[model samples]
Target: MKNSFYLILIGCVLLACSTSKPEVVMVTKTIATKDTIRIANDSLDYEVIIIDAGFSSWLDSRAYPRKYHSLNYLESKNQLYVSEWNNRVLQPQLYNPNLYEMTINYDPMLRYGYEVNYLIYNYMIYFQNTNKQKLFGTVPTR
Candidate 1:
């Protein structure tokens, strides 16, 4: 009977150890290719932006259903700055700033249907004063 009780205790200990959460690691690297960015394994719902000198075939492949509207117009340069409205946070103080500035380098081709290499920039926006603070907050302790 004593041996059986010890066995049960050992089993409980093993189960508890197995259920412990694993640690997460963060690493940053720059991309030098035209491939779509891989989503992080631990990422939740977050906004993203891509700024390109012009659109690419790769961009079309990863395009979301929602569309972006032009945010500002530069008449002198004849260029329009655009942003995804769905990714913007509607907070008074939290401004979704543009993060990337890609310059086009590729020649115009029939496949891509463009002559300029697109300069692309990406941005991730978060609301500063939303109840969704827990989205970026620390994990709770039980």
Candidate 2:
């Protein structure tokens, strides 16, 4: 009787262990999209592809010397450069009053996409970094 009870207990333990829940796995899906812009000059038109969505903000954050320029000065300088780049590169009809306000329209249908914005955004950054001057002039450090 003792042996039979032990055998029964062992069988029950084995069954319980075998009946444990199965492991679960989860997967996420991602999709990639592409955008491009055409910039026209007097003699030629150029096509530019944009890949990074955060290019505009990133350009703003990195354009001027953080150690030298205050937050307000940095922002002002970025805006000045953007305005000049816009007049030089983008289609004139696409220029919007909202630009100087720093409230650009990113909708591909309405204005342009990440790429177009970044193209000009980076252009301004390059111009500022190389010239060490804003499009208009230098900002007062405080």
Give each model a TM-score.
Answer: 0.16, 0.26
- What do the candidate models score in CA lDDT, each in turn? 0.23, 0.35
Q: Mind giving the per-residue lDDT tens digits that candidate 2 earns over 1-142?
A: 2223223322322332332233312121212243222232211122233233443344456543334434344444445654564453345355432222122212222222233333444544543453354545653321
Kindly give the stretch of ten consecutive residues in candidate 1 with the minimal lDDT sum: 108-117
Per-residue lDDT value at 38 in model 1: 23
Native-referenced Cα lDDT, model 2: 0.35
Strongest candidate by TM-score: 2
Q: Which ten residues in a row have the lowest lDDT in candidate 2?
A: 101-110
lDDT of 1 by residue, 70-142 (tens): 2121111112112222123233245432321221121111111011102221111111111122222342221
